[model samples]
Target: MGAVATLVAGLGIATATSANAAAGCRVTYANGGQWPGGFTANVTVTNLGDRIDGWRLGWTFASGQAVSQAWNATVTASGTQVTAANVGHNAVLATNGSASFGFNGTWTGSNPAPAAFTLNGVACTGSVGQPSQSPSAPGPGPSASSSPSTPPTTPPPAGDAMAAVAAMQPGWNLGNSLDATGADETSWGNPRITEALLDGIKAQGFKSIRIPVTWGQHQAGAPDYTIDAAYLARVKEVVGWALDDGFYVMVNIHHDSWQWINTMPADRTNVLARYNATWTQLAAAFRDSPAKLVLESVNEPQFTGSSGDAQNATLLNELNTSFRTIVRNSGGGNVTRLLVLPTLHTSADQARLDELTATFTAMNDPNLIATVHYYGYWPFSVNIAGGYRFDATAQKDLTDMFDRISTTFVARGIPVIIGEYGLLGFDRHTGTIEQGEKLKFFELFGAQARANNITTMLWDNGQHFGRTSLQWSDPELIAQIRSSWTTRSGTAASDLVFSARSAAITSKTMTLNLNGTTFTGLRQGSTELVRGTDYTISGDQLTLSAALLTRLSGSRAYGVNATLHVHFSTGVPWRLNLITHDTPVLSAATGTTSAFTIPTTFRGDQLATMEATYADGSNAGPQNWTPFKEFDYTFAPDYTGNVITLKPEFFADVTDGSRVTLKFHFWSGAVVTYYVTKSGTTVTGTLA
Candidate 1:
């Protein structure tokens, strides 16, 4: 019964949906509004009928209709007739509802509401335009942009960090580092950080500030901690500035929950009581505060039992319960304080939050939004050594993670609030300009979140914060950083993924695939795949950039020991690792291990853990890894066209220094030599 619309553009707006249902099947459409000539959309179809075979959804537009682009889902049209499809993601819609998919497209003719469509020969009766018209007329829908080759084109598809960094120029958090001034103070140095940060926050287009503080400084020996009027006034002063600056402010018990985050017993009564007490007094402190203030409960609680490494469903329940309990105990409109709850494992991996995602359902709080921290992948995101490349794999991983979060929770009516997501403070990626990378990270993070109507915040601590710190401390390309947030995609054409080894070339050139179809990527000596024109292949060089196409592309650069994910095979199955390297080259040494005499060496770095190269975690994205030693690595010779592509950011000074020697351990009986060469952003090696 919902109205199906082609869609429009706006912020915090609800989406439109279009679809028709038949006697036995129900179909749903997303981003299906056939838009104007210079526009596009990403569409999704879901089946609502019983299990059968494959699917086919057909519709008839008025007339002179044209298609610009689409992805995640497929499309095929004949004359005035039309049909859309996906890569068999969720083909058979279960019982209750069924739906066909949609995508981004640019049309030339009229886009009046098209006639009803049929799903697998049956009519669809559900909604279309699942969400509002995307702000970026050519934005990537929920499905497309799965593997971005560049930054987004419009402003909306950018990540939350990008958006926030762009909108909020003078943002503030009541709680920062411990100050040397003692008496409950922490400092990351420089008075300018606050002003510059606030400026940056406001510039990011956000008008909000969250002040999180632990009252223990005033409380001392247990129970209702005596409120320190001086500290209290300081908090208010900062909050006042933010309000004056026109920014929304959020403040709560941050580290106060530190003791509570780790190892919460089965009976969490004490934690809940403490939560109530803290909010009771804290709320009273700012009860007169305006609607811009929000209250959040506890930080990341690992709940140390053998079962819940990052806090289990039980602990999350306690967190949610604490949310309501804080409101009930806090006197006035604490009920409308826009409370926040996090997913399991601290960060927003909705797959982990089995229940909390839908917690709003049980509670009738309309202003509530689920809060989370998406830090990409931990080991990779957090630099164990200092310099590491945030390569394409890592970038893709974060993108997919956000997509999962949206599908799992956001679309279900609950809004997502990303409180922390940025480069780690500790030893992190080195080649990247701390500030530039910081800006880019937020740029994509915010844009993508905005794409699905999700709101987000960036964690600005000592390591990543800088009015002038991050860039100066590191040798960075500062001018490259953009000061605003808008929709962004990866560098698709300039990504530079081509075989350059002598064996691969054979004096013969190759063609590249954009989404799937064939397209001319290189002409004569040109290599980059730019947006404005058509491309064709000619000579062997692939006509690309010496600076742009010389190697692999990613978020930012890093110094020596930059972290990277090394994927390879280990015989029986496959293996992978999160490693640190100061170079971009890969080397291999063929060996034998059919029957290990006494496999004493741990080939991968003992400091790292392993996982599949692919998110699937199956043999699909399998990789190899081990502790680092002189002869520590063993290669899987099976997967051919097998070359390890590393990001230049991971290397120390490959552009000027001598050609470094890269070592690898390969398994094959005797000696096997391979040829290596560099592409614009990629490095290729072939069995010679």
Candidate 2:
């Protein structure tokens, strides 16, 4: 979904006239999506020079274009020149840091890029500051960003925080429900919270529930900023139900992190006032609640207009200290309630971990826990930049982050909770990640968290669980995740084994991943296959004899004829599909750029991945780093419709009038080549 297209000729942007004060910078302007007479553009300004407090980016439109709407920054235009200033939360740009903003605009004649850009009156050249020069100014002094001289009165040791968090193993997030930003709780398409939903989760073996609440939209104007009594009551009702259901419940300030809390540095006075008042009301409302309840200071706390990390850390510490004080001083169960604190962005980076470590040590309170979030490796998690597999690179990223948390907090006697964990691509659609790869990610993610003595809460956001049906969207994937919490599951290099129907059947071999487990045997339904005659295992290699494959492919059926279940020494069994297929054929057709559908005879095969390339062998589509464009982004195979649809966004990025070759990879190990050319608004496709 993320695209970086080439700049059109004679429409080049970001040419600086003079170097000015700072070393240099770079500006990237790309078309995210386009349509007739209107389009959306994304701009990224990288600060390659010294750090800047507040920045104003200026550029000139080559064509007669006008900005209609913008986000992440304020865009204003005067004739042909346009300027974008940083917003409250994105005002500071440290060296090597970049600020991204997008806008929708209207264009006539042609949509040419700007010819130049200026950042704070200085031209951008995308160069680093000289080695001899130090940062323009040193970070804030300790006095400006230091902890409180006196720590809050440590709450009486009520219970072990470690035990409390540990008991919250395998948690579920009540996401997109109370956290919805619309008028009411059900504004985000999720059904209203019912006892039946909680019962279903409890029945599914979940020990904890995290309810994220957004109070800003429900509260009245300043001063008291009283949350609608009815909304507060509704939140209380849900919490009470979960508590009664014997689930460890966590409630926190959710979207306010970006709404108001992110403006802390620029408007600390009002921000902290509202923050404290909200928690005060919360403490009073749940004052006498049971000990199973926990309070999180903030959700991924962020700061605005800060010089750098040091100032940001200081500001966060101030908020955490205040939250501890307010809740601890309030009466009843608040005296020793377990509290959760997060680093900047709730990230696992070393600097963020270190900052949180300092906060825990300074608090010196036994009933405190640390929290962070995990979304797996960026590329693979989002299915971009050729990260289509959960290979060693993606595996190591998970290991390294958990290892750092294990050492920084878990090993230091502090319990760390992965407040939210899942694939970022899932936010768009589950199909964004391949089915097997997604399963492996969760399986390993659960095992690693358990090994590190940490707790993880899955971020559902209405994507995983069905509130109306009370059933999981994918039952098998959920089963694998739940199984990983207790033991290891064996998997293979892939879940698919392709057998071409047109060729003679031969012995098929696949390398097993094993994953710290041993393969027991293979089974079809309730019948077991013979060892040497049917299949053989040498080391981690698994071979199915041609005779066994012949029987499975009876009459050389076109499609999956049988599913073989692979049993392991422990945990859930892996499933392997034996699919029989032949080379697919594509029909040449014509259509507009908006919906250019290519007719195809799949011949009992499933789509794997697609690649696009030009004559020069350069990547020819979006995410140009790899020839393989995203699965559902650039082109999608609609098996039911028997057509492969090329999205409009893909054509917007392709060079007009150029022949682009498309490689369609099928699950049956078949590669079908097709070509398409875009000229003006018409597109033509031909099979190779």
Candidate 3:
């Protein structure tokens, strides 16, 4: 039998009709920012059913529009029909609960909204709205009507800056294009800015926007580095759009590689002069604008490829101090305008945080926000292929990172902004990331960010969400992101009954012996798999209802592991008896003069016997297995489901780049023959 097993339940299997009856839901599609050729769109799904364990939404474009990238959902298209399946966190929804995702797409001549939508194969009740017009092309400059001299200003109230920072949650970034090469916003793929687009974002429930602008290209040469009036006006126009809609906006100098602010010692005078000149102009421009408009000193200031030194940290601190002094002296609302400062390369690493803490703590500004960018584990968050698993290790790493930030900064009255944090695309496909895994990543990331008083802003580089269509490329992804913000409040790991743990599934109807555990919240991955929709609990026995079993079986393949988490109202620690089913299959084996190779898909380190079986049915001596030498020998073997190299003298007859045939005997009474070949540093084996 495999890790998964089919068993006849003592109780009768539940019928699907009851599950299908509770499938009522509705969807709404809205346009976000867009360009002449491309656009962004967002879709929101509302559950009108009895609690749902999982959901899938479908729609078709009226025009010949092609989706380029997506987030928060697993999006796939066949002809004109588009399907968005719920990721892990947003899969479960109680009645009236909602989830959203966004995407970026391209349209040739016309972009029309899909007229209808269906949720979980059932037709949705609401009507889809028409696609709004894309923002017009950039003009020579903003018109007098669009650019007001005395804009309606309601400055953010003066108080503890950390309080203001705490109020800002779930931020969005206008990525790639606006901060693209030169001042031509459309130079990248994004469309012109529009009020309708800002309205769409506000409607989608984002409270903050980070506008990354490349100011160096738009400024004059030499001593003063005077910013062009037209470029400033254009930026001011966009900032006005956000401010008019009552959004907390942060604008910064992004991608000024030509200025070399990172190599500060040599270019200190020139960089500081330019920096001072730029902020002086911006501060004067929005001097009377609402306090909601924040000015970030610099974006990722660091020496190229170097993990910051003390000198670089000190230079950055000097630049930040200069920025504060310049802004305060510029007059008007500049005195109280919120300012964001970045550490070396905007890293959240311990060394950089320590330096930033030492520097920023000395500066006496209540309106200052320390900023950092978190890509975290590069293999999972930024990798383009495979390796995007949000498993136990990932959870721990992320939790620890956030906890460090909380202890080092937030606890000490320094508010932090995760200016940019998001998983990149896996290959070119938008839906390549497993929906459940991505959702779980967001759920934990959001929860940690919220708990730590750190605000998180998503980084969208035109690929994730379209600015032209003003609709999310992946509606489900946006929903998961939103759910993280909405559902994270008042929840902490200490409050949970089973904060982080995994249980195995061995039978069709398995019972979890909770050992007198009580929980107020229970979730499978990020989603709150409901009691009636997913399972039923009686006394200490938590039963996997047949409906859930059927759903799980259909959604996942055999041998894959699933996780469950619980929270308690009483804060009592809960005990659970875990059951594991590890039916080991023959993995791999190879040999060389200096080393032997054995690959496995198992977890943990366990010693076993290895023997050779001859063609004459004779067997060699059973050898006591040892840990692979190429791995970290200090710890127990880490079975990464990949090849492991061993240094053993027994296989010394085989040399590098050679082929050998051997029959391997396992301790489990299994015997198999394999043909192994080596090429340079690589070894491969196939069962014979």
Compute the lDDT of residue 276 as modeled in candidate 2.
Answer: 90
Q: Could you tell me how far off, in angstroms, the CA of residue 287 lies in candidate 2 after the best superposition?
A: 1.8
lDDT of 2 by residue, 57-170 (tens): 878898878665455555666567777766543455666766666565667678888888877555666665342222221112111111223222222135788867877877
- What are the runs in model 1 whose C-alpha is more than 4 Å off? 1-183, 187-197, 260-263, 266-269, 306-311, 328-333, 383-396, 425-447, 464-484, 489-542, 545-625, 628-688
Q: Whose lDDT is greatest here?
A: 2
RMSD values for the candidates in order, in angstroms, are 19.1, 27.8, 16.0
Each candidate: how many clashes? 149, 1, 42
Q: Which stretches of model 3 miss by more than 4 angstroms?
A: 1-156, 257-259, 305-308, 383-387, 425-432, 488-688
Cα lDDT, all candidates: 0.40, 0.79, 0.59
Residue range 231-328, candidate 1, lDDT tens digits:
77766776676665556676656665555544456536655555566666677877667655566666554565536433467666766676666575
RMSD of 2: 27.8
lDDT of 1 at 11: 11
Best by TM-score: 2
At residue 625, what lDDT does model 2 achieve?
A: 82
